[model samples]
Target: MKALILAGGKGTRLWPLSRELMPKQFVRFIDGESLFQKTVKRALLFSRPEELFVVTNRDYRFRVLDDLRELDVEVPTGNVLLEPVGRNTLPAIFWGMKTIQEMFGDSVVAVLPSDHLIDANEDYLTAFKRAERLAKNYLVAFGIKPTRPHTGYGYIKPGEAIEGGYRVEEFREKPDIETAKRYVEANYLWNSGMFALDTELFIDEVKRHAPEVYAAFENASTVGEAYVEVPDVSIDYGLMEKTEEAAVVPLNVYWNDLGSFDAIYDALEKDGNGNAIKVRGKNAYHLGIRSRDNLIMTERLTATVGVEDLIIIDTGDALLIARRGEGQRVREVYRQLKERNDERVLVHRTAYRPWGSYTVLEENDRYKIKRLTVLPGKKLSLQMHYHRSEHWVVVRGTARVAVGDREILLRPGESTFIPAGVRHRLENPGRIVLEVIETQIGEYLGEDDIVRFEDDFGREGDG
Candidate 1:
């Protein structure tokens, strides 16, 4: 069976850490491995790398490529489908299914999210076997056995047994605590955001139910064109709730969406005081006196006194302090910042580009300083800025710098300048990372206002 992974969500609930350029899937939170990597590793357990497809937005294309490359599990870059805009799950899944039909005709496909944690390795295999048997006549969805009265997830009620799975009786949204307890008492399973279906069968149902979406994809010549016209909706609202061929297979798996800080805290190993403390180095000390059930992640020594049920995340440029359960409401903070045109809401202190990454070390009204790291064998786009003039000093490795019309190779402690409106590009020809200190002197030194003459990553006028 082919595997389809959805990796395009903004993950606004996980703010301060998850930014526009880098979402939660790519960030390493629970363990050293990212959620996307974990999901890919899980996907590989059943399907080969060749049989996997990642559906994400154009903005996340490079991050996806970089993450997959780091894993050393190379798949065809073309298999990573780039959506022009996010139209939610319906279009994304439909596009993947259509592509699967073209590549491997009428095959069974499993749809999974890239940011969820599930360890049903054995149970998952069993569920897949059941799903394959049932997918001939039903669109099978995996349901998790609820451990508590969780109001964050939807509920799936299973009817009498039908071959390998049960007929789906009804689907319910997140209910009140009493209602959730009632659901648990009645043996309703938590709706796991996973589905296994026959590609041809799913397409047929979409054609019958979500014909507008079907028409959009069917008429377009390329994935980009299809994405431009596809209406933004979800599968549950468009097809699953309307179709008659729905079935649920009870999957006894350890699953958590990790949608909040509390969920993340629960997933991590806690200390003696029921706190999750992540220290930078062994020499650093975190003295938490009278603190309980808190999460403290920092790059330096962080001490918490008389604090409980809080989330303290320090990313150098931004520090977030919020009540434990209120982490999901961090979207409101993002919205407020966005309304005020704050860059902190969109980009992080350390912004990643295709060539490398840059961190805003310091900034002010007249000048701004940045620490730029260019990966070996990669070059920044040959571009020019209209408002800012830059001075670059090589700190670690050698840099091949192009300033205006003059080309020069600079070693450690070497410096160069590019006047405003002059074409320039930075390249690294060595085997190590090229670290440089860039100081900018300009009136308005925003990230925009750049004219690219050439680019290697095909990123221009897109962001």
Candidate 2:
């Protein structure tokens, strides 16, 4: 069986931590493993590394690579499909299935989301087995039987038993609390965003029901053209709701989409005060006094006093405080920031790149200070900034610096200056990581001032 992972969603509801450049799937909230890494690990449990496929956007390609490397799991890079434009689940899944058909020919493929929190217990394996058996004749969807009234997730009603699962009777949107209470009482399952598909059957159904989506993938020679022509529709809206072959297998294992902070709170381990503290213990400490039932996540020493049932997310740049069950509305705040062109919406204090990452220590109108880390054997693009000049001081390891035409090897405490418009490159030539303190001074110190003459990651003109 081949595994297809959908990793393209920019988790906006998880703002302040999850950004446009770095989404929630790649953000490691706990366990030193991001949701994407966990998903990959789960995928590996059933399928080999070569048979695993990831569908993500063009922007997140490097982040995907970095995380996979961090886990020490190497997969064929070509299996990581890059969606030039996101048209939602329909296209992403369709593209992945089509590729699987070409490579392996009519295999049973399990579709999973890269950003969900799930318990990989015995029930999880049992559900997958049930779905696989059902997928031979039907497009099977794994559903979580709701334990409580949850207004956050869509509901699915199961009908007659078929194979190891049941036919999907009805699908419902996110309902109000009263409606959710009714759904919970009626034994409706939460629509876990995971599906098992027989590649050929799914393609045939897509062609019959979502012809527009099918035609785009079928006719295009490149993914770029396919995305532009494809309709921005979801698999549920395009095929599952319209097809007669829908089925849902009950996955009784614990599952949470982690779509909002409230869900995150529910999924995390809580303290004696019923507070969900994400940062506590060895690496960091979170002390709560008189705080009850609050969901809090922070890096530095964070303490809450007399706050109850509140979602308090504190990042270096932004802080969010809201009542419980109000976490879904974080998207509204993100919308406002995007409309106003707020830079905070796209990045945090630290930004990751293909080489490594850089943290902005300080910034002002005339100057900016950054701490850059270069992985061993990795190098920055051979480029120059037109509007800013840079001074780099090597703090650790060795650096092979190229400024204009001259090149030199610099050790710790050694510094170099590059005037504006001078082509320069920084490289870690040693076996250890290269750490450097960079100071920039100019009229315009924006990241876009870079003009890359050479880049290894094809990110010459990125922000």
Candidate 3:
């Protein structure tokens, strides 16, 4: 069996903590390992590293590489597929399945989302094996019995039991609270968004059900060409609901999509007072004073006063305070921010690049200051700013600097100046991390004001 992991979720509801560039899958919420890492580990249980494949956004190339390095496992280089743009689950799944078939003809593949949290104990393993067995004749969707009226997830009505699972009767969208309650009362299962299927058979079913989607990719040689014609539809709408082969396996294990703050709270270990707190470091803490059943995830010492069933998430730059039941509405905050062209919607105060990362120390109308960290042997683009002049002060290790025609090396406490429109590059030639403080003075300072003469990451246009 092979593994096809979809890792292209934007994680809008998990905002402030999960930004556009740094989504939930790459984040280390519980242990030091991320959800993506956990998913990879889970896949390793049933498939070899060479048989595991990943589908994620093209911009997340470095992030995927970074996490793979963190896992300390050497997988095949050709297995990670990067989608230029996300067209929802159907396209990602289709492309992944197609790639898998090309690599290993006629296969039983388990489709898993990289962002979900699942306890892969005995129950999970049993259900997974059953799903795999059923996949020879069915496009198996692993379903969790609804613990409550969860409006965040779609409800799947299970029909008669087959060999090891049930045929799917109906697929329901996220409903109102009353509707969700009714479905839960009727023993409806929450759609787990995980599946197992035979690659060729699944494609045949997809072609039979969603011809436009099939038309989009069935003839294309590359995913890049295929995605251009792909419709923006989810797997439920494009294939699952339409396919007669759709089946469900009851998975009685701990599972959560972590789609909302309330889900995060539920996934967390609660204290004696029913409060769930996630602190970034020792200096930051949840000092609860008569606060019960509150979920606090912050980077500072946060104290609640007489609050109950509240969700407070502070990420230094933004704070979200909502009722535990109202976590689904948090996506509205992200939508509003995006509509208003707020930078917070796109990035945090610190931004990560392919080479390393940089944190905005201070910014205003006239100038902006940033602390840039360049990884060992990594270099920034040989580029120049159109509207800004830069001053770089090396603070750690050694920096190989290139300003205009001159190539110079700088040590700690050393500095260099580059006037506007002068080609400059920063590289770390040492074995340690090189830290530098960069101050930019300009009439207009924007991240897009770069003209790259050379780049190592094959990047162009705005960063």
TM values, all candidates: 0.96, 0.97, 0.96
Candidate 3 lDDT by residue in tens digits, 224-342: 88899899999999999998889999999889999998899999999999999899957998888899999899988998989999989898778999999999888999999999988
Candidate 3 lDDT score at position 374: 96
- Against the true structure, candidate 1 reaches a TM-score of 0.96
Candidate rank order under TM-score: 2, 1, 3
Model 1 residue pairs with clashes: none
Alpha-carbon runs more than 4 Å astray in model 2: 280-284, 461-463
Per-residue CA lDDT of candidate 1, range 199-264, in tens?
989999999999989999999997778878889888888988889999999899889998877777
Local distance difference test, each candidate: 0.88, 0.90, 0.90
Weakest lDDT window of 10 consecutive positions for candidate 3:
454-463
Clashes of 3: 0
Runs of candidate 3 exceeding 4 Å displacement: 177-182, 460-463
Predicted model with the maximum TM-score: 2
